[model samples]
Target: MKIYALLFLVLCLSQQLHAKEIDVYAFCDASTKFLKKLSVLPLEDLVAVKSAIAASSSLEELSVASGVPYIDWIEDTQKQLLVSESDAKLIVFEQVKPIEFSRYSRVINMHGVKDHRLWDKVLNDCVSVNLAALID
Candidate 1:
């Protein structure tokens, strides 16, 4: 009986862990250069990239403004874009989604690439804004 109870607890804990979803933002240029570079990255490299992006002052501001935590970066691809279901919110470049990322509660579409300085304003206008609106 104790073993069965332990198993149940483990299962419940695992489910809760998986429930925590990370928001993934896919950024790309007109040629999808950034996206292409991102897609080929290994899992470790991806995590490193996430850490680096999260560490950026600009992205930190964006996270605060958008009220999103754990934002991961990925490259958008035609094949990956076909799948409609995802556990993460997607902030994609304009016209990148062919099927539409309906799974995510928030799908932010950014217009033409902007300099870091303008990113805060863009995110504030398109999404949400907070004390971190000003990016230095």
Candidate 2:
């Protein structure tokens, strides 16, 4: 009985240890980039991104922002609608279901990797909107 219980515990722990990374963070990041390039985005999206960034004090974000006014403004204003969905539950592989990411983050590339070929495929399969067409 003791061995069976221990084995069960080990299996449970192993499963959790190997749980897949949630797409939420990746989705958020991609959405941020996509929205920034757009000339227009919903007010709610801007709110969410701003809220997330505001709530964080990471040196990485600070350094990434640099000192450009337009860049800073873009970072804040592009994520308005995406904010409302920020409270939704983050799903895992076991919960596979069609996800309608926020309008700001409508496009997603599921090919990101953390292995040796990572640099070769940064945003490899991500969608690229035509900013020129939208502006016209």
Candidate 3:
């Protein structure tokens, strides 16, 4: 029993030490302008953003929409990543306001209109670069 307990503790400690850290960024729209803006970001920043997004739990969004218990989870996850609400970037093409957890760095209202051309441009760019493949 003692050896079993020691082995379990060692395994747990090793896993924690090897855990990957992630960074979170909030984006409103997928547009060329937004993509261009992101292109200037440091490679580390981009990696962190991707890691955070990939690790993010969809349950949080569901909880937000359903009025469920997500605050604790969000807070805990953000804490783990050392990201504050102010540090999170919110990028969007529309005039939509940023949410509580994010800060808007650039917002192009475009008269409340959305341009699919820009959207498609961004999507095509993403596909060409295989950005989705990097998420996991």
Candidate 4:
């Protein structure tokens, strides 16, 4: 019986570990060429990008302001609304949905990466109206 219990515990731990190793797709707007053009290291680039996002007046403003061109901001909004539905506290995919297209009026999408100083700044600045916490 003890051996069986130990085996069960091991199985459970393995499952939990696998669950935590989730795959989330992170995307930047196509307009974010400014960051892309830089040859800096990943850390430096991310910091610079974060600074820019933090300074934006709103998410819509951020999207427009980003250096990546051709990014579909309209599609991004739909993703936010969908992630907000499950009470999941985190969104892990990359695809943008279709429902939020009509409402995408150069508006803000509060969903963003976790642990980003810019994300916190946006939260404090009232740029992201929904202010959903993102995953790191």
Candidate 5:
């Protein structure tokens, strides 16, 4: 029994160590060239992406860096690359978030909007169509 417990602990530790790390992508439109370009972003670019995560960074920075105003979030869900909005909108893995978003980003970009009412609505209603969780 002790041996079994030890084995279980070891397995858990190994799994934790080997867990897949999430990757970040910003999209402005659905374009193969854009997807391919993002897939091969340099280490510096990767750092930029990492910094641009929600609350930690802004998509504007990514836009300035990449010359694209749109962004998308992509992750591996159930062995398939799932692309989705933070609001749980499902998009093709290669699809880019629209620059002229009427919902979240627009409000976010608006002057004196002050409250994240629009963003909160989308976030509260977020539901994954392909994945178990929306934000992971």
Candidate 6:
């Protein structure tokens, strides 16, 4: 009926209002301290960890390997929150497209992190474990 339709629309709008998103570029800039430290290492050493990252079966495993705790990464990006799912989807598409990243590990390593100074909130904490795995 008309009333049910109205209620459904209202619910959808409310969910959209509560939805959140992160800007990939901005997030990369925030940078985790752990990842910043890794950036200082020789590229070969960093590349050497690729196997460990790939072997990890879960985020917790990757977190342990990298010494970065697992947290709700996207939600933690308070600076780049987006209410619209469409915008978030577009951003994700732009960053992950043109090439296939079947695994999370591959995607995380391809995008170098940002952040030089060891700040209060390390990019490692706010990012997905896959990215953090490359830190150590």
RMSD of each: 19.2, 19.6, 17.3, 17.1, 17.7, 15.7
Q: Write the per-residue lDDT of candidate 5 for residues 7-126, one digit (tens) a residue.
A: 222222323333233111111112212333344445454444434432223444434543543422222221232323442223311122222122223223332333457433323332
Question: Model 5, stretches more than 4 Å misplaced?
Answer: 1-30, 56-66, 70-136
lDDT of 6 at 104: 27
Assess each prediction's global lDDT (C-alpha) against the native: 0.29, 0.29, 0.34, 0.30, 0.30, 0.37
TM-score of 1: 0.20
- The C-alpha local distance difference test score for the whole of candidate 3 amounts to 0.34
Candidate 2 structure quality by residue, lDDT tens digits, 10-61: 2223233222432323433464454344314455654554444444343244
TM-score of 5: 0.22
lDDT of candidate 3 over 25-86, digit per residue (tens): 11113233554455455655545544443344454433343233434434443454466633
Runs of candidate 3 with Cα error greater than 4 angstroms are 1-30, 59-136
Best-to-worst order by TM-score is 6, 3, 4, 5, 1, 2
Candidate 4 clash pair list: 30-68, 30-69, 31-67, 31-68, 31-69, 32-67, 32-68, 33-67, 33-68
After best superposition, candidate 5 residue 133: deviation in angstroms?
A: 18
**What's the C-alpha lDDT at position 118 in model 3?**
55
Per-residue accuracy of model 6 over 1-136 as CA lDDT, tens digit each: 1222232222223234331332322444443333455555655655545555555555454555445442333222222554344444443333222111122233245335453433333333334432332232
Question: What's the lDDT for candidate 1?
Answer: 0.29
Assess candidate 4 and give its lDDT.
Answer: 0.30
Worst 10 residues of 2 by lDDT: 91-100
Q: Judging by TM-score against the true structure, name the best candidate.
A: 6
Q: Per-candidate TM vs. native? A: 0.20, 0.18, 0.25, 0.22, 0.22, 0.31
| Candidate 1, superposed: residue stretches over 4 Å from native | 1-31, 58-136
Q: Kindly report which residue pairs in candidate 1 clash with one another.
A: none
